[model samples]
Target: MITMPSIGDNLARLRRRAGFTQENLAERSTVSVSVIRKLERGDRDSASLPTLRKLATALDVTTVALFHPVPRFAPGNTDDRDDLYVMRRVLQPARALSGGGVVTLADDEDAPSSTDVWQSVREINGMFRDSDYAAGVAALPTAITYARAATSAAPEPHQATAWEQLAQTYQTAAMILIQLRKDDLAYYALGLAIDAAHQAGSDMLVASAVCSENWLLTRQARFNEAERAALATAEAIEPSLTRSPQSDIATWGWLNLGAAAAATRNNRMDVAMDSLRRARAAAHVAVGYRSPHVTHWTTFSPAVVAMREVELAMVTGDAGRALKAARSVPSSARPAITYQRFRLDVAAAHIERRHHDEALDVLLQLRATAAGWLRYQRYAHTLTSRLLRSRARAIPLELRDLADFLDVSD
Candidate 1:
């Protein structure tokens, strides 16, 4: 079967094969230097199609070539999805696995409702929310089994909640594995989430599944594809999905768009700006009292908004604006995973401004935080090493240590 490397892998490969560093690619492709940094790091998901075309043209390749599948574990081939996904999860030091025992989901072919199957799933989510990575990872197999079984079972209208629950479980598993640097496994699980959502025939379920998949697509840097998926999901569900407090389907769609826009290339600033405006409008519409889920998404404080703005500013080469936005991100509000990502963006912005000291400071923090998670992410280490070596400045000592640990050198 033909497969595509996630956007990050494809861009990195094309850039190197064309004998271009991130800086070189940034200069040629009209994509911001920070975007090049994130794309190569595998932390970003989307890029503007126009920018992609530029990069493709520069490499003397078609746009489709950017989506070419990366072979699994070929010698000198460091694009393995699994390693990358694992590294993403553990990159934050304070998020070490803590509690929650493994709970298995048994498949009963005769069962009519998926509710029983979802009990284990809820437990897993709780464990994850509590930062219990070990617990979440251990329970993943059971959740997958139950979800598959639920999908195969006969559907009952009353069992919609069960199916939704199952879909969410699969999504949760995907999220965990992605953070763990297991992208292939995460993709497989996300596929299951999509299947469960489809089978459930619930718009809310579908939206939730798409929300999760959107991030996965972004990591590959497939911005246009990811936005399409989000928009399609929203449009499909809007008419059927109620506008009540129970679920703010519209708001979710807008958030997805905002994120997608932030990932888009520097050349598409207008498109990105439009998407953010819509996102802000959607959030405004969601101000009234609502369900826990709706409130969680809609009322999610300005912190996430600020983060997106920082991303937008970085992509636009507005260092002052990006720094201003970055400063608005609440230190404690972000989880370790997201905080590390924010720092990387800040570092890139500093690099753009030629503030080497600031950039090195951010890089050091990343190194300190990311070292604990190194065992989980070979791909990130490889990319970071390459960036470090290619840059004119001396590599930070901490990152040097991390490179040695991963056995990856630029």
Candidate 2:
């Protein structure tokens, strides 16, 4: 018979696999030694989400990985054929670019026109917003080639627009690549994006590129550099505030959001809060108007600022404050991805507070609303496993089915 391991069992196994003694893990995670000992010994039945997050960070693993045996198909597992195939495809253009080869459009009877390229870029941006990664990946290569061609072929007046389109396309590709954990490829794509933005000669576009660079840095765990990049970008564009206050405010607010996120990651709570305050001030000036420029997906509005505030609070280990801020975001103001993140934040806060049922409810809502999106997020698996382990009663059928779908065993 197959045996189901408890969370403690899984934790102990992962700790051993990481070659960390209890004392070492305790020191690294900043959890007390006694708590770590109790957890590994199964004497403690549950842990706060923040504590688990710290331990997972120290272990260089996702929190979900600490809850159960790593799946055969896990992303980093060499044996995962699907992962291997996706990684190969995602890295193809980056590898070619690194080797000093440009990706060319396949020979055809007619090349895509500038209008066609612009329309395609917009469609791909929509696909990204909808979280349709596969579709975006399928469309990207041709779009990239067409956008690059248009940039070179368009009239002087139209050249900047074409370059902006090309930059947006590359930025979209970088976004998808990062989500796939193909950070090297993502970095290459972002560099291309920045170059195109500079060629476009738009301060807004450059600021957008800087914002994306900050995001890449944050994902790579270079939090200090991410903070610096964001702050510099915001400052560089501050002079434009008088000429185009709304556009400048949007860009500035978005950069502050990035700065806040980086600060939060570095455990600089004061810095993070200060950044958020600046973002909030900018948002007030913009008054919820969306910038006409395609800001590389940076939306600056009151709601968006609040969303970042909630996220910062979560990162700072203030679950109550996070939940409170999340609740204040109006539904009309919440974009699809932002709403999804808000729900996840709510669930995370609940988990930290030991409100398992409430946490599960929020997760179930997310699953129902965006099952495909939720499936790929490691935190979803972590939250599900926590719920399963924390409750002594038989698992709810809905929760169990969700866990099974995510391939989370015990």
Predicted structure with the largest TM-score when compared to the true one? 2
lDDT of model 1, residue 199: 66
Shift of residue 405 alpha carbon in model 2, Å = 2.5
Off by over 4 Å in 1: 1-119, 126-137, 147-158, 177-185, 237-243, 246-255, 284-299, 334-337, 363-399, 405-410
Candidate 2 residue 81 C-alpha distance from true site, Å: 9.3
lDDT of each: 0.57, 0.71
Model 2 CA lDDT for position 331: 69
Candidate 2, clashing residue pairs?
none
lDDT of 2 by residue, 262-319 (tens): 9999989788888888888887777656645445645567888888777778877999
TM-score of each: 0.58, 0.74
Every model: Cα RMSD to truth = 19.6, 19.1
